[model samples]
Target: MKNKSGGHRRSKSARNEAAAGNKNGRRRRNKSARHGATADDGDRLSKLPNDLLLNILERVDTLDAIRTCILSKQMLNLPTMLSQFFLSAGSIPGHHDKACLFSCSEVFRTNNAVARVTDNILCTRNPKIAITKLKIRFILMPHDSLTIAKSVARAMATQKVGAAEFEIRTEKDYEDCSPADLLQFAKQLNNFVGACWDTFAGLTRLWLCNMRFGELDIPNILSTCKLLESLHLTNCDSGTDSVLQVKHAQLVELQVDYGEFDRIELTCLPKLQRVIYNYWCTYEDPLYFGFVPQLSKLNLTKTGIRSEKILELSQLLANVPSLSDLHLDFESEKIWVIPECPKLLTPVLSKLQHVNLENLPEGCDLAWTMFFLEAAPFLKELCITVWDHWCIMATDPEFRKKYGFCQKADVNWKPHVPDFKHKNLVKLTINGFQPDDGFMEYIRNILEHAVNITEISLYDRKVCGSCGELAPEIKDKVCPSRYPQTDEERKQITEGLGLASRAMVHFRS
Candidate 1:
């Protein structure tokens, strides 16, 4: 939610585009250095057999690969015989990346080029050579999409394609696009999907960006995509506070980023394994799980001010009993999740093995996190990081008050089981560790609770250059952190934890 990558990793098309951008005249010199000093280094590299050259070509942008093949007569048939193609309209020369960054004409021209090149390859490729992968990232332009979608549908019909994917992007980013622009983009996308339903049916992954789609538009698209295993919706929403009810059988993963829905109700996804929801606009609980039998991983990230009701995991994840991995990121905002009693949470979090709590506000109590230990009986690792992220934090007093920011204070929590001896907790990691009396006592308290713990790692506060230095007024409000560095200090800290436990405590600098 707070600036995390929705795309799991950089796609092949993005990597290829970056490589194509940096492939200058220095390539031959580097090639010569690698294959021994020789003047025929470039030729030697290019003259390799088709199989070896094709391997290198496939690693680069499809346009550059085509150009490389066009430069050599012997490699003319390689483009036609290639098994993979990743074409991105945004990567076109002087298109979205160059001086005409926001020019609509440039966008249209680049999309046309992408559609043309995609058609030339998919429509003319050899039938004997099966396409192992086909990916296209193009703008949602009407004419260009029609051409690209029809070519893709034809390729899917004529060629045996594996892992077919589409990453649809609007000409303008979500921040820059207006309401009319978003509506138009969604209309164009609907037309494209309806026009090329066959192409979308073969897609294994689809990422949509920047659209205010109709309430039913999303469900209709999902119905057409029978084989889609993953779907990502970024900055996409319907009207005011619409309830998003999803029921896809084959979807294995789902990501919703900054969506403006009141709540997402997972009706029936029997095969879903992972879900990531971030920065929802609604004040209610973000999700309700209904029938996700195989789901094991859930990551919920949000930045909330005060007045947002405490999120109760017991009710939200009541139906998702199979969850084994849980992560909650607060984005340095107010504590949102209430420390529910163990009896209520343990039912849904029974299989949970790992829990990561990130960006807990500095100076607040760590005692609230022990609720997880009391609840998830099978949990093995508990990791939490405390920091004051100034990048997202407003320093002005008026601005902070207007947004209803909570003052830095401890979260009032009392452990339900004061004498709880957890046997399954094997490790505990705390970042932003301090050597103060309260912090050290907190460590002692943890050692007393998790008697079976094997390791306790204490790390210094992570540096955030992007956050810069906090304002002078705000800096004084944060808790002073002085980690034990010298031997004497370490000895005193260890001695302070006398008779707590035998865990190997490491003071990681």
Candidate 2:
């Protein structure tokens, strides 16, 4: 009986050992599963090819792209491969907090973050890689500007960047901030350009806005950018300067909008094919164009015109012998006065083809309209938009003082008829057409002169809030026009104008 009891105790001990072993095995399996998950999550992005990764980064903002560098060991050097860098303070993550109370501290924090990311990428970029473009938009803080200038200089010193665009803007809260900061930023920019003069020689495009510089700096800066093809200056100024002259051989396109300069002279831009000039300020100095033989398109929007000046338009167009497309917006001002000398009215724009005139005041003599018809014998299309009362009231006071309200000139002061008819004119479009004697006479002159006219379009001034500024909430509620036209009026205009049989007429209200 004692031997049997010993054997049973040994079996019980064996069972206990078996239970412990099973528990240990289960623990080991659970640990393995946890580790497998972590390994699977380990830096899958690192598997992508470097070129593919760089392309992906290019589509994202530069701030986000730089932040990816810290993701893993493989991504540490990825930002160095970027060919294009675009940094904007407003685009930084977490910069736009949805809270109603946006504090100054948040602005500072956002600006600091932008500076840190930009400096890191620019400083660590591969010197051998050629950066094709670098664009930066940020507020003009004094210390930040200096830091940015230094960073740019360092990057330019190491890399072969082809184009650089800088946009200095004011913060939303500081829109009306003092000009002192802008002045300081401009000084830093001048210094940077001077230090990196040779590096900018291969630059193809340059754009700057809301900066101030001296008159002498303008020429100096352009002289270095010998290969620049396009230049745009908006709301820029030269301190205490009246004239800004741009002379470049390789420049193909130039735009100057709302710049605080009295006069602008374009002298040696032989390859310049397009020019856009728009300024609303009152200035009497004329724009002098010289040697621009390839100028094909000229757009003038709300440009100040001097009615007292003689042959102003003629002098401006004399140099652009190849001009084909012309767009002019008088901005509801009547400055097209008859020139004193008939010879001065003659401009041989033989190659001109398309003309677009907008915001022409009502009841004014058609002499200004006739000037181009007689000048461009090969013109193919002419579009005119008549001004409404709202547009007339919005005209600047200086413009109104210089050129009084629109009125027909004395009956004795009729424009001279062209020696040659408009044989090539094909299309005529008159928007906001009114049934007045002056307008009818204008149409009659065109019908009699344009032998090859094919189509005429007359559109009554519809109630159009599209042309005027309306509040977003009330835009849908407001009626477009107070007076709706009847179909009978349309028929009367068609019959009164004696629509030419060769031309098809389309009338719409």
Candidate 3:
């Protein structure tokens, strides 16, 4: 009996030893599976061609591209092979956390990261590989000046960057910060400009925004970039009172938006094909365009036209003999109320094909429209967007009270009757179409005059949700439709006017 019991105990111990071995084997298999999975991922990434990897990196922001360098050995050099680099504080990962109330510590950390990343990129990048484009946008801080300057200098030093953009924005509005503080930031930009002029020999496109010019002559600054093709200056301020002048031989496209200058003169832009000028603030002087024979497209947005110099616009149009597409937006209604003046010899735009006019004030006669239709005899398309500030005021009670409803007046002034007939006009689009007396007269004039008109598209004026009360109501108010035009109304408009039988009128909601 004792022998049998001892044998049973040995059998139990053997079973226990078998179970322990099985558990150890399972652990070994699991660990191997985990390691194998990681290796497979790494191998897949490493097997990709260098060019393919570089293409992938270029699509992301520079900060994200840099982060991939730590992911695997294959991606370590991918950032260096990129042809374009875009570095902005807004692009930094996790930097937008509570952005509006960003703290000082967060700023310090972001600044350090920016400096480190930029320095590493400039220093580690292969000299043979050329960076074709570089853009940097950041809020200028006191400690950020030197680092940004160095980065810009390093980029320009390559002598191969074809397009570059640099923008310095403030954390707060200009009104919130003192002028001295802003000037201090502006001083740092001078270093970047120096680097640009010294090394930007291959640059073709350059855009600078929100930077202080500080008595620096813009014309002289642009002269250094001999190869620049497109230039855009937005909200750039200069402390000097001198009229800003731009003259570039190689420039093809130029856009100036909301500058602090009193006047801007464009002279000797021989190759310029397109020019966009947008100014809303009050200025006594007029914009001057000179010797741009190749200019084909000109867009003027929110430009102020003084009551006295209305004739100057006609003279300015004489300079661009080749202008085909013209867009004009007057700043105020005062332009429409000019007094009786002697007939001026307005230049004819024989090549003008398309004309777009925006913010056509109420109660204004169609004299301006007549001016263009007479000048552009070959106009193929005309689009007019009517000005209705009442739509905006309907949203805010305070604004509505401050700026009362636009007072309607009788159309008393008669413009020069044009003997010219428009034969080439095919399409006309009028947005914000109200069936007021002025609009009716405008449409009648077009239908009677444009002999070859093919189609007229009329769109109801847009209004905010708050302005529902002020919107025009149909006579049959039971349906409660906004901008309802009945079949009877269309019949009346088309019957009297000698509209072409082939011409179709469309009313868009």
Candidate 4:
């Protein structure tokens, strides 16, 4: 407690030293204040509770959450304390180019910054690290192979694994997997959760991209995931003859993209609601496909099925009393099969609120409309994508003869509104619009008949930029006034805007 100078004898020099000390202290204080004001300020953050901060972090991606650590010392530990594990490699900061790097490449690099952070989280303690959702995206790079495999394994081990969505895309030259590699992949599913045991028992939803499994291997995977609710498989290397026997009663939605199926059987799936099958142009099938009682919607697009079989299948669907929405597309050139068309198969569908048909021959208008007249009595909406050139031909008798041979002047071919009065029909859409005399006559008849029709859409063919610039010429060709009387009525008819408004309409198909 003794002073450096004699207590009573302190001189001016001592006072000067005291003043310098005060100045030095103030300088240090101001320097800290300046730096803390911008980068190290923690006063405002103290307002939020730990729980509230965690909530905010949960909504963002893991990369952004980790960046919060730079905020202050308090935040440094908060990122690691998080219970929900998020493993998205693409969205990390400072790597904007790699943000959407999942597509268009084959070797993912694992030595990146995001992977290091992920490894830390995987290896950390704090047993609260429960992963509810796992999303992995890769470009199929060789360097990323080990990283992806390891990350996936870690996620499966620590997480509850509510959903595991894998998106793997490779270049066109990528070879299909050998049978041994696929089997090994399947076997690893068991190690994810020992109880799963090659069965995704806990997985309610599964999505795979660019995967390949043999014909015999598919059923094995399906049987394991008994509770699967949604299954989507796209561009898999599996052969078309692969028999997919899915009998899960809990499966509600199934979508197969461009696949070959030797035989697809569904013995039981009482809860199944929707199925979409997209086939390549080379596929040929007269085989019968079955469905569950609860099935409601079915879409068959671009399949190389014979036209006759399409009619048979349509008739077959009448048996599914609960079915409400059906979409069937056929190649324009295929000959249509006219089986003994059954009376609208189900009274439930007879009361159908909406119906949609596309790509059928314009000359087969009677056959096309007749199906609607019989099947959808309560139809409230109708859409037709007519090929204008055919619809515009001047009374082609041969055309009518070829399509059931009904004469244009024949009573049976007359446009009858009463037959499909459908008092409920409120909206009509006709795409691929062209204003030829024949088309004008058809429009006049449709407008006059569909009294309840409130709105009709008229859209031209989708043209490229060059063609779009030539739209004036194209319009002149299609809209020329061959018959002034008919053209005037058609124009006046659409004045209500209910006849020619350009709006996209969607109906049950």
Candidate 5:
């Protein structure tokens, strides 16, 4: 009887100890949860591998990366080890917009910020780690520029910099500057580039704005950049109405925005893969494609037409057979691309996989877009966004008339391949969706033709760029979306479209 009593006492003691341990574990887990992570997770984050920590820091600005990891000493060391650095001329405190560059003192301060940031980073970096990429954008000032160029030159000499980029800007915006200002800006920029030939030669990318260079000036600049891969020209050209010819051996991407050129002829760019041109109307034919075998993506955005010609895609992309992505933004104006016969378009769009048509006018017939489905047999996805952007749009009647902006008209079209069946179209997304006859009919027609379609996304019209600063008078300009909200309405539409799975149709609330 004494032995049994002793065994019972030992068992009771063991139970009490287990209950105490459970209470302690719950307390620790609850405490960790309050900090938005478990204790184990916090330790793991602090002890992450060096490569992973560097990858996280490299995505943000150099200053932002430092602030995020302010608590971790190990993390603080990782910023110096990042392979790529993108530094911009810091903006003014109250004047974050580029329009504020008109202030001379503020512009000088911005230039100083660029020099200050570049000096701090390049001068005190970890020399053992090779910098693979470095991009710096700053205003054009002789004094500050000299300081920046010296720092970059020293860093390049000491480190194995794989690529460098520079974005040069002036004090005033392109529209705000006079002809004399533009000419002077061009001279300053030209001198800057000339002085930094060694620095620019190693540049993989370059961006310069508000420069009116001579006919041979741009070509001479290109010659100095022997290893340049990407060139961005903004509001720049040789003459008021001159033909700009580009021939670069190593150039892979070209972007021309608001350039004052009658026509741009890409004579020979062997490695060019992407091209983006915006707000160009100086000539009937905005561009002439020449010897760009590897070109796969092209983006063209135009607000209103000042040219005398309607663009034909078949002819524009006649040589680009490897094109996989094409984006066209009409700025809610007249549609520029001509829907030609399938035979004429199929060769140009043969390997095209993705197509995005943005800012189509609301009243236009969606049937005109069917031309792509019939032409590009390999197209995998098609997205369309229809909206009239108000903020940037010209609303004054007199200004609209001067630019020849016409009334919103429908583009008449009839499918050349009336019974054509698409086998590769996998998804369709429409942003400006409405549950009306026109929309429903178009969707039903698509369902019938796209036999392998899996997902159809419908979303309300999204205000791009800025939605916060809306004028009271134009607040009602946004058209209310009529997308079905109730589950029953959605079900009816789903059944009406004959989709087998409700999961395949998505309605973004």
Candidate 6:
């Protein structure tokens, strides 16, 4: 060897030593040494096995993943391993702060990483199991206007990605965002969008809207997401052609707010339990609206509809045997003259225990109570809002204002023979109770007849308009019985009533 070359001839160890290269090569050599094997040892130790790696990632949240990326150079690409990525923000990053905190650029990169992970995991020649749940939550200031769609599509890839839950919540002032983004997302995934109807193969929940949308689009979305168990759609617009046909049998809860719909039919869902429609503009009744028998709770507030619609809804709602809670509040500055709310007797309300009828017309309390009693015969609690007795006496022109006394007409008189033979009655609360014969009689009847009664509350207005005078008769005297004991109690009650009266005036105006 010395004769052949001027330099020393390369030996096996020398060649091996020369081959030992950068940090990665040195680490490989070290790993082999640690295992007590040859440098060419095929058996390699993995930081995490395939299954275990996926399992560990399944437990780690998105923030923790980002934290992990900073842990070591080895974890630099670990974000690509996760099928689900969540970016949660508490408050919108202000202008001075980094807009990149939740900027479109960051989301774009994150979404690209998510896509790569899906392709690697799901499209592998021998693809492993796909992720079942992908949840992306944006809770703070107006979600980056463009964040939702990219997140949704990354969740809805056709070949392998399964069920996904997307939640985007923002304050009411993010007006710059458009509804087209949502519509475009749905339209893009129209094929995968039918996941809800396929039983266990679809989306479980979808909460969309801090913006407005047409009604037709919403029902289509609902129909596609038939397997959806809980759905919340707010500030959406619907058209006459738009029909809400809930065809899924697995839906449990639905909340639709400030929308308009032409026909809402629910034949596909058999397991639906609750529905809340607030400030909606729809007047169309579902073809077989009340045929379902398993629903439990319903709230329809400020839904501009004819009296006949309420009666129809009530009749339909009565068929459900499991309903227990009901709230229907329709109030306005202009008088709403509608047929009396129908007496509901569905098995659904058989166990109803609590009811709240707020902002009802003044003289409707007795009739409202009667309607409530007929529907929820088993009711144990009720709340009614009306003007204060003292306020009426002082403010009503019909009354000789100055003292706490009001004429019958000034009181919005509704003659009623108060009786509580129902026996199930336990607690009673009357707001705006002033010292008047009608008011006194109402209170006395509840205390006298409710044998099971234990607690009774009477709140009076802060300003007593009745000049503290009576009609001067034994039968009509209001101060004869059951009054608060101290000035403090009286003042507290009066203050509460006064505040409540002011609140009503504010609400009504």
C-alpha lDDT score of every prediction, in listed order: 0.83, 0.68, 0.64, 0.52, 0.82, 0.49
Which residue segments of model 1 deviate by more than 4 Å?
1-36, 40-44, 47-60, 67-78, 91-109, 469-503, 507-509
- Against the true structure, what is each candidate's TM-score? 0.83, 0.66, 0.69, 0.59, 0.84, 0.51
Q: Is candidate 1 or candidate 2 better by lDDT?
A: 1
Could you tell me which residue pairs clash in candidate 5? none
What lDDT score goes with residue 267 in model 4? 57
Candidate 1: worst 10 consecutive residues by lDDT? Answer: 91-100
Q: Write the per-residue lDDT of candidate 3 for residues 368-411, one digit (tens) a residue.
A: 56566655668899998765444332334464345442333333
Pairs with steric clashes in candidate 3: none
Model 5 residue 258 CA deviation in Å: 1.0
Across residues 184-279, which tens digit of lDDT does each residue of candidate 2 receive?
Answer: 656766776766565456556666666667877778878988888888776666743458888998999988877567777888888999988775
Error of 4 at 509 (Å): 23
Model 4 alpha-carbon miss at residue 187, Å: 9.7
Candidate 3: list runs displaced more than 4 Å.
1-60, 64-78, 91-116, 122-132, 140-159, 170-172, 177-185, 199-203, 209-216, 280-283, 303-311, 331-333, 336-348, 390-419, 462-503
Please give the lDDT score at residue 281 for candidate 3: 42
What are the runs in model 4 whose C-alpha is more than 4 Å off?
1-107, 110-132, 138-161, 168-199, 237-240, 280-291, 303-311, 315-319, 328-370, 383-418, 435-452, 458-509
- Listed per model in order, the count of residue pairs whose N, CA or C atoms clash below 3 Å is 0, 2, 0, 11, 0, 21
Candidate 4 per-residue lDDT, tens place, 1-509, comes to 34767456557776786667877757877888877765545465644788888788767776677777566677777776675545454522222342445542222332244456566665663546565655544433344434545655565666545555444333222134455544444344323323433325545666554445666455666676666788776654355466667677688988776644654566567788887766532333422346587887776655222322334445445445576666654333332333233243435465455555554443444233444544565667766654423222323456544544322221133323344454556776665555454455655555555567666565554333333344353446443322223545445545533444423222111
Name the candidate that leads on lDDT. 1
244-308, model 1: which lDDT tens digit per residue? 88889899999998868898888999999999999887778889888999999999898878878
Which 10-residue window in model 4 sums to the lowest lDDT? 406-415
* Alpha-carbon RMSD, candidate 6: 18.0
List candidate 6 segments past 4 Å from native: 1-86, 89-134, 138-164, 168-201, 210-226, 283-291, 303-313, 316-318, 329-348, 358-367, 384-420, 428-450, 455-509
**Candidate 2: what lDDT?**
0.68
TM-score of 4: 0.59
Our tally of clashes for model 4 stands at 11
